[model samples]
Target: MATMKDVAQLAGVSTATVSRALMNPEKVSSSTRKRVEDAVLEAGYSPNSLARNLRRMNLKPL
Candidate 1:
């Protein structure tokens, strides 16, 4: 399985940038977003849906 570090290296960005691009593309510049997106597509990287859902839940206050 491809990891975030791989994506970061391929994208020429940091892992945090990769995470932000995946989770919140709007937060990154368009060019950077494109690079990240392209890297993700080329690498066939998919975010962990369960972890993503957990993060979504955490973002919402009880």
Candidate 2:
């Protein structure tokens, strides 16, 4: 599976940027979003929803 790091690297951005792009695309600038979208496609990245929610909730996986 492709990791967030892979997508971030491909997008030439920090992991936080990748997170924001994936979760709240409307917040990022159009240029940033375009780069992120292209990188995501090239990198074959897919966010793990459980992990995302877990991070947001500040909880560990069981």
Candidate 3:
């Protein structure tokens, strides 16, 4: 599975930028958002929601 880092590399942007593009498109410029979106499709990246929730709760996944 392609990770966020892969998307970031493909987009030539930081992972934080990629996250912002996805979670809050308004936070990033239109061109930057487009780049991240294209990179996501090219890299086949899928966000791990379960892991994200775990991290938010300060828990580790088994």
Model 3 TM-score (2 dp):
0.88
Best by TM-score: 3
Per-residue alpha-carbon lDDT of candidate 1 for residues 3-61, written as tens digits (9 for 90 to 100): 78899999999999999998898999999999999999898888777666877888643
* Total clashing pairs for each candidate: 0, 0, 0
In candidate 1, which residue pairs get closer than 3 Å at backbone N, Cα or C atoms, i.e. clash?
A: none
TM-score of each: 0.74, 0.78, 0.88
Residue-level lDDT tens digits of model 3 in 1-62: 89899999999999999999999999999999999999999999888889889989999999
**Model 2 segments beyond 4 Å from truth?**
60-62
Q: Arrange candidates by lDDT, highest first: which order? A: 3, 2, 1
Kindly list the per-residue Cα lDDT of model 2 for residues 1-62, writing each as its tens digit.
Answer: 88989988998999899889888999899899899899999988888889989989999999
Q: Candidates' lDDT values, in order?
A: 0.89, 0.90, 0.95
State the local distance difference test value for candidate 1. Answer: 0.89
Please list the residue runs of candidate 1 whose C-alpha ends up more than 4 Å from where it truly belongs after superposition.
Answer: 49-62
Q: Sort the predicted structures by TM-score, highest score first.
A: 3, 2, 1
